[model samples]
Target: MNRFDAIIIGAGPAGLTTALVLAQAGKEVVVLERGEYPGSKNMFGGVLYSKGLHELIPHFWDKAPVERPVARWVISALDKEASFSLDYKNARYTEAPYNAFTVLRSKFDSWYARQAEAAGATLLTETIVEDFIYDQQRVVGVKTGREDGELYADVVVAADGVNSLAARKGVIKKDLSPDDVSLGVKEILAMPAESINRAFSLTGNEGAAYTFVGAATQGIPGGGFIYTNKDKLSIGIVVKLSSLSKTGRRPEDLLEDFKQHPMIWPLIKEGEIREYLAHLIPEGGQTSSKSLYKGGLLATGDAGGFTLSTGFRVEGANLAIMSGMAAAETIKRSSRSRDFSEKGLSIYPDLLRQYGVLADMEKFRHAPNFLKNPRLYQSYPELVCQISNALFSVEPGPKKGIGEMVKEARKGKQLSRFEIIKDIYAGWRGLA
Candidate 1:
């Protein structure tokens, strides 16, 4: 009874998607999750891109417990007391077939797991996978913390997350370096739906997503985010793990500081804190993992380092969904002749490419390194704010030209013309 056609570790978006696909194809699949239930330990910035979930369950927003459809995107650069923002809103995004929706992972993942279960996959919750059960060098199953712990299968899928024991035990990837990951701390704040609408300038179910840099992280090489939900807000900051350690500041302390920022405080002043969460995010870009698969094992989601973090945005769930679909496709193809070797699973990368997961990651491979430039989080924002203040102030003797304002802002900052040009060029190359 413990033996199955396939075994999947973790029950996040990635593993559940893989199980859903394979189960629909008539494959016997079992998913093991260590949390009290699916999504119990999961957290994110709250936006779920439509393309991925739509492919799995067409028009999923109709059935899923999503919070709100994102209708506006705002990116703000902040100084100590000033903020410059670029806000974009599209009426089309609020309609059906939307671009993306805000989701509470705890509720969404539970609903998603049920979809997999309804499709004939078995879900075992509160079950920790101790290690992989190997035959020769090929992964066959997992050893769980159950009475009869050993469960065998033809193939094992590791979707256990950034610190995936399945991936490490199966030798699919090595340990993550501090520089390759990021630390994210978040809080869910509850407010009235009407208040949310008025504050963010949204109607009905429309929501807004905001990202902040510069003083948002106190000039740290990281940023803050706020995603509007139906009656709540998801607010957080993500920082480079290596840089965070060097600062001797607590992630929670940073979050407190962000909440008290002049621009952020007003919006969240009436909100009541409902939940606090912290998680490690993979931001290593192309260098996060050494391999995606080995022998009979395949890594997907954060386990495979499939996340993409450009300075302006961070995406993981959509990539996880796509990677999961690719893993399922690879397994189906390999099962045709019963070859689960590393060579047999070589098609996994190609499948990921075909699904557009790897392609997206590859495109932003240099983003991680580019975001490490301290000037982006510190000097640039201060300069821009100073220039803006000078341009808009009425006390100035005579209105100065934009050039004079820029040169004045550059004074005492020690920034050179060539340095500014080089940084602009680098930004174009890395983010454009």
Candidate 2:
């Protein structure tokens, strides 16, 4: 058995960051990964938020394989034949501390893992951590799929993704429910650079991201996204697991339907689909997982249910990096004191709270359910898109003002004014 000051499971962004931070602090750290390489099996929607990430590796964009810096964000209200988009851009974002950027997880994770290695941490690929090596009730180490299998550590940071078995070993009290989890399926489509630039109205390293809600998922409690990469497009759908399964719809079928939407069809007209991937993520916040830390162990990234999927945005990678950094800082402090127990590991969870990560998730806990409304996921988008189409169709209808048309559209939906007010009130309260 090999011994180390700390052992981290999963070499994705979270684990790698944690290892790098702790190792740089002069604590011995080893990261065990199940993939052939760090990012070989990873996938994401492609946007990286700046706030949490920049705190981990200052000026990361200088060395990272970032595809494009996002300059504009658009949310499209969609239907089968039409769509409406609300876009926002700022010149201030063109400079440092930029809002967000696009990334290919496979490329990004490998780069991040290498950073950890450069910081004096050992990274083990193709090594799966099977279970915790427990002493009494405290987790003191792990058993691996490697030869001779066992390794000891003072603490463990389980930065594995959403369906983490590390958290399943009785540390956390409850199992996640279908309603709290989302199944996301994505495809990366390659298109010629010129074609993409012309299609998206781009000049240089600027990117566009669009989120489609309503009539896009065939009435599922979720939506679709199209993220522009340098030479490809990352497009996909994320739906509540329970809702999809109950409706008896395959994610691929849903993707096909999404792609067929009149507003979506023209956007990807001739691009060739290059890759397909799916992952389960935590949609509902605190109620989604039972534990974030336990005896001699700390959980970071998706393992702690940190992904926040508010209807308009998804912020997982940023949160993962932040949590990993916090865990490492906690471990560093614990190492100095030589107290690696449940009470000691409790510091990691406390640090997460102090970092406002847990607090933000708690504050937005209502956002996910408020998003579950079928009207918001279906009829509303159609309403908005139809309104935009009507306003721009260049056909002869009664020349009504935008205000009159908006009133009529609201009344036409057989929706009560009270309900609209309530939804607006709830959405604002949950997400604002």
Candidate 3:
């Protein structure tokens, strides 16, 4: 068996970051990836916030495969006919150490894995860790599918993703329910760089990120997103598995409808689709993230439900990097003490708290329940469009007041002021 200080499963942002951190600190680390290469099996909405990456590798954007810096962010609500949008653009995002940049995971993950390898961490691809080689109760190694593939380590980190097999095998002691996951389907549409700039009205390397509600997901408890790469656009829809099951709508079907929306079609009208992918994402907030570390095992990233989907913002990669670094720090301490027990590894959660991963999780603890509201996905969007239509239309006769226009829009929708008020209060309590 090959021995190392730590063995990390899955080479996504989380796993790769863990390898980089531990290896930089002179700890022998090995990352086992099941894909052909690091990012071959990974997919995301294409946005990477710089906070975590900056900490790991300063000025990473100078050499990494960054698509574009997001100078504008737009959030919109769509109805069958009309849509309401909010756009915010700032020059600060285009400057040094920018806010967030779009990336192709396949390209980014490959580059990230190389960085880890350069730091003296061994990376093995096309290797599947079927199970843990346990010594009584503690995980001392991983059992891979390859011949004589048992690799021993002082500690193992499960950064495998949402459907983490490691977490399912009593390492984390929690079962993920259908309601706790979201099925994300995305399509990569390709176009000329000049054409992309023209369509989005961008100059130089500036980019835009857009989030949509309402008809984007057929009014389901999910949302749609559009992110721009250099010469392509990554567009997708993410919906709760529980909500999707009841709607009887396939994820692809929903994405096709979103692509055909009046406001969305124009942006990608002439672009050719290059690929389509489906991935499972963790949507259960902090409450679902119980027992992140047990014995010599620690779960991070999607495995630990570290993703957050605020109604206005959806973030994960940044938090994944943060958690992975925290895990690496914990493992480094455990290695120094030569104690890889549950008690020795217990500081992982404390570091997560000290680094704000746990704090952010707690702060947005109610986002999952708050986002499940059907009104946010359906009624409110339609209402906003209807009210806008009524307010902007030039009638042949007398015009109605704002109050009357709102009443007229809600007349047939079966929505009331009380229901709206109730949701408003719940939204405040949950998201605010």
Candidate 4:
């Protein structure tokens, strides 16, 4: 068995990042990945936050296999007929130090792995770590899936995503509830570049993204998203597991309902669905889920459930990259001290908090419940679309007063004046 200073499992953002930072710091690190290729088994809804990422790999936008630079961002309250939208744009993100970009995981993770390899870290793909190899109390290395495949490392960083083996046993005793999980299904719709630009109302490499609240989830606790790629559009819906289990509605059915929405149908018309993907994402995070570190062991990324959600805004990949780097940094510091134990691993959590990931999640703790608001998914969006249709109707006899139409629409949705104010207060406060 070959020994290393550190071993990182799962070659995703977190693992690759751990290797990069450790390798750069001159640690002999090995990243063990199960997939034949780095990103072969990875999938996402398709948006990258370049904020924390830039800190790891400076000038990352230059060679990353990103799809588009985002320009317009939208948030919508959907109804049966029409939807209400809030749109924003800033050309400030168009140049260097860009705000965000869209990427396919297959390409992005592969490119990231190469960066880690360039830093001299060994990347072992088509390899799965079956379990931990412990020395009485601490994990010394891993038992792999391949024959005669046992490797040793002084320390191990678990970056194996939501279902991490590092979390096995009593280490992280949290089991995900259906309410805490969301199933997301996305399709790659291919279209002519001209059509995509005209439909999304963008020119150049600029892209658009949206989060849909109402009919898209068919009364489930989730939102629909659409991101414009170069000649493709990544469109999907994320519905809560509890909602799906109770309603017994299949993801495919929910996808159709979303695509058939009056608001979404027009934009995707004449496009061909090129690829389809369905995956579950943990939305509740790992606040009470697990212990982040033990003697000679640490966990990062999805393994730690570091995803942040505020009804619409998401921050998973950014946290993954950061956590991975932090883990590697922890290893580097511990190496100099010649200590790798529970006390040494304490630095991992301190670093995470110091970098503000913990504080950020704590600040937005109300997001999960806000997303479960039945009114938003069941009533609000449809009512807004109706109000728009009624206010703009061209009647032959007479036009109703805008105020009167709005009241009628509100009444039709079973919303009271008090409820409207209450909903706004709750939503805004929770998001705050």
lDDT values of the candidates? Answer: 0.90, 0.82, 0.89, 0.84
Clashing pairs in 1: none
**Order the candidates by lDDT, highest first — what do you get?**
1, 3, 4, 2
Q: Ten consecutive residues with minimal summed lDDT in candidate 3?
A: 287-296
Over 4-106, each residue of candidate 4 has an lDDT whose tens digit, in order, gives 9999999999899889988988889999999989998787888988888898888899989888888889899887766889998888767779888988898
lDDT of 4 at 40: 87
- In model 3, which regions exceed 4 Å deviation? 287-290
Candidate 3: lDDT over CA atoms? 0.89
> Pick by lDDT: which candidate is best?
1
What stretches of model 1 exceed 4 Å from their correct place?
A: 167-170, 287-290
The alpha-carbon lDDT assigned to residue 263 of candidate 3 equals 88
Better of 1 and 2 by TM-score: 1
Q: Kindly indicate the candidate among 2 and 3 with the higher lDDT.
A: 3
Model 3: colliding residue pairs: none
Per-residue lDDT tens digits for candidate 1, residues 1-432, read 999989999999999999999999999999999999999989888888999989889999999999999999999989999998899999999888899999999999999999999999999999999988889999998999998989999999999998899545548766788898889999999999998888888999999999999998888888999999999999999888998999898999999999999999988888999999999998777833239988889999989988887765678999999999999999999999789998898999989989999887778766777888898888888898898898778883677889999999888877899989988888887887
Query: Over all chains combined, what TM-score does candidate 4 have?
Result: 0.94
Relative to the true structure, candidate 1 reaches a TM of 0.98
TM-score, per-candidate, Cα-based: 0.98, 0.94, 0.98, 0.94
Model 2 alpha-carbon miss at residue 427, Å? 1.2
Give the worst 10-residue stretch by lDDT in candidate 1. 166-175
How many residue-pair clashes does candidate 4 contain? Answer: 6
